[model samples]
Target: MHIAQDDIMQESYPTVLQLYKLALLVPQSTAVVERGFSAMNDMCTDLRSLGQQTLDSLMRINLYQEELLEEDLELVVDLFKNKKERDMPL
Candidate 1:
């Protein structure tokens, strides 16, 4: 007895593939959200009053400028000094 071999290619299931794609698109962790809330709380404590824009700016700088956070105070002061210089020469 000889058995015939069926050569057939099967397409991936659409629903399974879509579900997988959706899973990848969704965030796996809430850590980022928690960190953001924590940062906001730290910036807006009872003793300190910060406007929404100011708080957002501070949070952005704190989150993005990890290296700047460690920089020397003199360096930061110098940056502000240079930034404050007038464009017109005396």
Candidate 2:
């Protein structure tokens, strides 16, 4: 039934995004995937040491047999933010 499909879609993605209209979130729909790419590209584009460059690749390249997902980037950004907050002196 249509209702069952609706429920399935809802459970599959974030609530903020409409399940039927996922294609309209151009550039990005839920989270900013490009920002991280730009960050990684900027970091990787210029390099003096090979180890740091490899690290950037590892962080940007998703290891789960895919490029990357929006949720994955958000989690990475959140992790970065938390670290920054924890390191900041009160």
Candidate 3:
């Protein structure tokens, strides 16, 4: 999970860095994505011009992040489960 800007330290970083670093992941869940989209929607409510290329790239990143978050959401929530609640809320 280490990221070094120095070319010499390239080996310090993992041989294969994560596609989406869970350690660096923020809010790291679908809830955050929903919140972010809500904020972006509100922020851009008055936006005039967004270029097609920029928009497409944004769409791609958003989709990738959303998918990553969704995929990890359940496994993460499970980590907080208590033995008593193991079979409580599914």
* Strongest candidate by TM-score: 1
- TM-score of every model? 0.58, 0.25, 0.24
Point out the higher-scoring one by lDDT: 1 or 2: 1
Query: What is the per-residue lDDT of model 2 for residues 37-71, given as tens digits with 9 covering 90 to 100?
Result: 65556655555444776855665564432546655
Given candidate 3, what's the lDDT at residue 77? 75
Tell me how far the alpha carbon of residue 81 in candidate 3 is from the true structure, in angstroms, after superposition.
35
- Give candidate 3 misplaced runs (Cα > 4 Å): 1-44, 66-90
True lDDT of residue 26, candidate 3: 60
Residue 85 displacement (Å), model 3: 50
lDDT of 1: 0.74
The worst-scoring run of ten residues by lDDT in candidate 2 lies at 62-71
Which residue pairs in candidate 3 have backbone atoms (N, alpha carbon, C) closer than 3 angstroms, thus clashing? none
Ranking by TM-score: 1, 2, 3
Per-candidate clash tally: 0, 0, 0
In candidate 2, stretches whose alpha carbon ends up further than 4 angstroms from where it belongs are 5-31, 49-57, 60-90
Candidate 1 minimal-lDDT segment of 10 residues: 1-10
